[model samples]
Target chain A: GGIITQTPKFLIGQEGQKLTLKCQQNFNHDTMYWYRQDSGKGLRLIYYSITENDLQKGDLSEGYDASREKKSSFSLTVTSAQKNEMAVFLCASSIPFSNERLFFGHGTKLSVL
Target chain B: GDSVTQTEGLVTLTKGLPVMLNCTYQTTYSPFLFWYVQHLNEAPKLLLKSSTDNKRTEHQGFYATLHKSSSSFHLQKSSVQLSDSALYFCALRNMLSGSFNKLTFGAGTRLAVCP
Candidate 1:
């Protein structure tokens, strides 16, 4: 059994500030993903990596950057935070196949002032 | 482009009552449908998934049948409990796309089960 850990369960940032969130998974899964969840909205894919050093953009990649330096770690960066912005960022990992179930982290709640 | 739709934004029910949440989808290719439940402050967990048509799949007392003719996969439970309160999301996987990992999700339905 493995767990996906997301750092800084709660995040607060100022407008125009840059913030970074980190994720680590011990599942050794081949694929990792970042998703953003807003109130009343479904989770939107930000970025995903098929393997270490690989990056793929999703529907909501704009204003966000991701890194997959190692298979166990995937990180996301918000280039410029918007004032009063609030959302939860989730990290997930899955086996090599697409049909495989995804394991998710608790998520990082972000609030920008 | 593929999309999923969950009609109810909020559903309030009493304990012991039957539970049902509507879901519909649109896609050009064969679809894999999934139901995910997220408790307060918890990560969303897969409740059920099915790719076969007219076959019922169930998990944790919840069940859903994939109706290709109606393009629906509605989640239901025989009886509700307070513990059943959570946000439910319906998602679709586009098998035709090269990146099958990509999933399109519905807006989500929030269920509040009271005693």
Candidate 2:
């Protein structure tokens, strides 16, 4: 079985600062996704990529940017951190088919000061 | 607009008790329902999923039936154990969407099982 690895288990950033989170998967999956998890809000999609160099916005992509520079890696960037903004960002990968389940990384917890 | 709703925010129960978590959804297209479970500090994993209407699908002692008419896919288990305690999320896939990767998730329900 393959694993999905997300770097920086925790992050602390100042207001208006830019922060980046990284994800790498060894499943060789064709699709990758970024999701934001907030308390009481479950998980909201931020962006997804079908393959290398492809990006698609999701329901909650307003302040985030994603890049898929390689088939095994996907990255997300927070444009400007907001004070008191604390959330967990998750990275997931899946096969090309719709019926396949996603494999997710542990997550990166972000705290903005 | 498509959305999934999980009504229970928190559920506390003793071991060996029955457990049920409610999930409902709204979508304009054909739906594929899924249940995911997340242990503390761990990533959420797929617990079960169903696409056939009115048919029950199960995995790892958890079961859910997709009801097309009611837009509900409730997760249930007859007996609960301490290991069953985790955050549960309901998700929907819009089969009619252009991209197959689009998955809309509901607010999760947290379950605590104690001895």
Candidate 3:
């Protein structure tokens, strides 16, 4: 059973500041994804990578950037934090082409001040 | 546009009672439905998935069947336990709109089991 680890479980950033969240998976899955979850709302996709060094934007990728530096790691960056913004960013990994199952990280809670 | 809808915001039940969570979806492709469970401060875990219509899929005492005709995949358990109290999310997979490995999720249902 492989695990997905996300670092800096909680983050606080000032308005207009740039923040980055990191994720690592040991599942050796070929696809990785980043999603944002707001209170009382559904999870929204931000970005995804099918393979190393590949990046694809999702429906909510306007102010976010993603990178798959290696097969085991995926990272997301918030271009500019907004005041009073609070959400949880989740990282997930899955197999190639098949939507079989996604192993998810515990999520990073972000609070912008 | 692909989307999932879980109408119940919260469900409270006594231990040993039956459990049911409603999940509905809207998608253009053949639906690939899934149920995910999330404990407090923990990552969401996959509970069950079904792409075949009218067939029930079971896991860890929970079961759900994807009904394409009605666009619904509701989760159910014969009996509820305190351990089953958690957040449940219904999801649908979509790859048609130039998106790769993307999942559309429901708002989520919080199940609280009281002993």
- For model 3, how does the per-residue alpha-carbon lDDT over B15-108 read when each residue is reduced to its tens digit? 9999999999998877788999999999999999988889999999999988888999999999999999999999998656454378899999
lDDT of 2 by residue, A23-58 (tens): 999999999999999989999999999999999999
Write one digit per residue (lDDT tens) for candidate 3, span A3-31. 99998899999999999999999999989
lDDT of 2 at B57: 89
**B24-90, model 1: which lDDT tens digit per residue?**
9999999999999999989888999999999999999999999999999999999999999999999
Which ten-residue region of model 3 chain A has the weakest summed lDDT? A95-104
| Model 1: pairs clashing at backbone N, Cα or C within 3 Å | none
Q: Candidate 2, which segments miss by more than 4 Å at Cα?
A: none
lDDT of 1: 0.93
RMSD to the true structure for each prediction, in A, is 0.8, 0.8, 1.3
The estimated TM-scores of all candidates read 0.98, 0.98, 0.96
Q: How far off is residue A100 in model 2, in Å? A: 0.4
How far off is model 3, as Cα RMSD? Answer: 1.3
Give lDDT: candidate 3, residue A97: 78
Residue B3's lDDT in candidate 1: 85
